[model samples]
Target: MTDATSRDGTRSGSTAQPVGGAKGPDELRRQIEQTRGELGDTVEELAGKADVKGRAKARAADLKDRAGAMTVHLRGSAGHTVRGGAGRADPPSRRARHAVRAGLGHPRAVLVAGAAAGVAVAASLARRHRHGPC
Candidate 1:
C-alpha cells in the first residue's frame, strides 16, 4: 500500500516505503522496531546529558579522589624529607614545590582547590570587615 501525500507534498503514515519498491509488511515492522530501539537509546543519552546534579556529583567525586591521592603523595614526600639523614626540616619553599609537583597531574582539582581557598580568604576578609577592626 502506498502512503497518502498531504497538501504540502509530504508523505504521511507507515505505508510509505523507500525509493526502490514497496517493502514487505514484515520488513517494515522490523525497520520500525529497529528505529524505535535506536530512538530509545538516543533519548536515554539525552536524558543522561540533562542530569546536571548527577554529573556534578560524579565530577565532585572524581576531584575528591584526585585530591586524596595528591594529599597522600605529598604526605609521603614530606615524611621522606623530614626523615632525611640531615636531621633537619625542609624549607617552606621546598614543601610548596612538592605540593606543586603533586598538583601538576590534576589541573581541575588544583583549580577547584585554589577557588575554594580564594572563597575562604574572601569569607575571612568579609567577616573581619563586618566586625570593624579586629
Candidate 2:
C-alpha cells in the first residue's frame, strides 16, 4: 500500500507541500505564505471556540433578544396576561382561580369523580346491609 504521509510529514492530500521539494524560490515563498495564512485562520477558529465567556455572553444576548420579541408579541395579543413580577397577587388566590378555571374546563372529569364516590358509598352500604349490622 502507498504511504499516506509524504517524506516531510505532511499528509498526501493536504495543501502543504514538502519543505525541501524541487520548486523555485518565489514558488516556495508563496507556498510558505499560504500555509501561514491557513494556520492563522485555524488558530483564530480554535481561539473562538476556546472563549467560553464570550460564547456565554453571545448566547445570553441571543436569549435576551428572543425573550424581548416574545414579550412584544404577548403584549400585542393580550396586555392583561402579559404581566411581569411587578404587581403580582398572592399565590393562594392565584392558584384557587386557576383551579376553578380548570375545573370548569373539564366538567366530564368532575362528573366521573362524583360518580366514583357515589358508587363507593353504595357498595359500602350494600355490604353493611348484607352483613346485617355487622
Candidate 3:
C-alpha cells in the first residue's frame, strides 16, 4: 500500500526486500538511485566491450607493450655484442654473425624484406642519378 510497494509486496519488481526492507520513502529513493548507478556502470562496461574500434585500440596497445618488452629482453641478452662494450668491442664479423642469427629465425620474411630494401635502394640511387644530388 506504500509508494514503493503494492498489495503484491512488489516494489518496481526489483526485489522482495526493497531498500533492504527499510520502511521509508527516503530508503526506497536511495535504493532506486543505487540501482541506477549500478546499471549505468554495467551499460558503460558493455558499451566499451562492444565498441570495435576501442577493442582494436586496446589490442594494439597490448601487442605494442609486449613487443617493447620483447625488445628489452633481446637487447639485454645481446647488449654486449650489439652495443660493443668499451675496450672489448666485438668485431664486425662477430656482429654480422649475430645479425645473421637473428634474421635466420624467419628466412622467408628476411629474404622478402631484403629484396624490398634492395629495390628501394636501387630506386633511390637511380633517382639521384637522374635528378642529380639533392
Candidate 4:
C-alpha cells in the first residue's frame, strides 16, 4: 500500500530500477507513464475498498451478472422449460416429476429451511455482539 517515492520524497510511483548510464528520454517517458497508470489503478482499488456502498453495489452487480450467466447456461442445458416456452424440449422423466410432486408441502423442506434461517440469525447476532455494528 506504500507509494514509491523518489529521492526528493515526492511520490515517483515507479519501482526501483537502476538508472542506466545512458537511458533515452522516450524510455523514461514510457516508464513514467507506466508508473502513473499503476498508481492510478492502485488508488482506484483503495478507494473502492473504502466505499462501502460502492463495494456493495459492485458485488451485487457481479452477483447479478453471474446469475444471468447461470440462467443462460441452465436454459441451454435444461431446455425450453426454463422460460415456459411452447413445449418442454427436455421434459423431466415421469419418476422425477412424481418425486417432485411428492415433495410439495414437504415438512422436511420447511424444517431444513427454517433451521438454516435460525442458525444464520443466531450467527449474525453473535457476530454483531462481538464486533458491535458492521
Model 1: how far residue 32 lies from native, Å: 1.1
lDDT of 2 by residue, 1-134 (tens): 34366676665654444645637888878878997999999999999999999999999999999999999988876645445445566589898999779889999997898899999999999999999877
Candidate 2 vs candidate 3, lDDT winner: 3
RMSD of 2: 11.0
User: Count of backbone clashes for each model?
Assistant: 0, 0, 0, 0
* RMSD vs true structure, all candidates: 11.3, 11.0, 8.1, 15.7
List of clashing residue pairs for candidate 1: none
* Strongest candidate by lDDT: 1
How far in Å is the alpha carbon of 42 misplaced in model 1? 0.9
lDDT of 1 by residue, 4-116 (tens): 77666556787554444427888878878988999999999999999999999999999999999999999999888878847777689999999899899888999999999
In model 1, how large is the Cα lDDT of residue 75?
Answer: 100
lDDT of each: 0.86, 0.82, 0.84, 0.79
Q: Give per-residue CA lDDT, model 4, range 1-134, as digits (tens).
A: 77665675456445556334128888888878988999999999998889999889989999999999999998787665645665645456876777667677597996788799999999999999999998
Candidates sorted by TM-score, best first: 2, 1, 3, 4
Better of 1 and 4 by TM-score: 1
State, as a TM-score between 0 and 1, how close model 3 is to the true structure: 0.47
Clashes of 4: 0
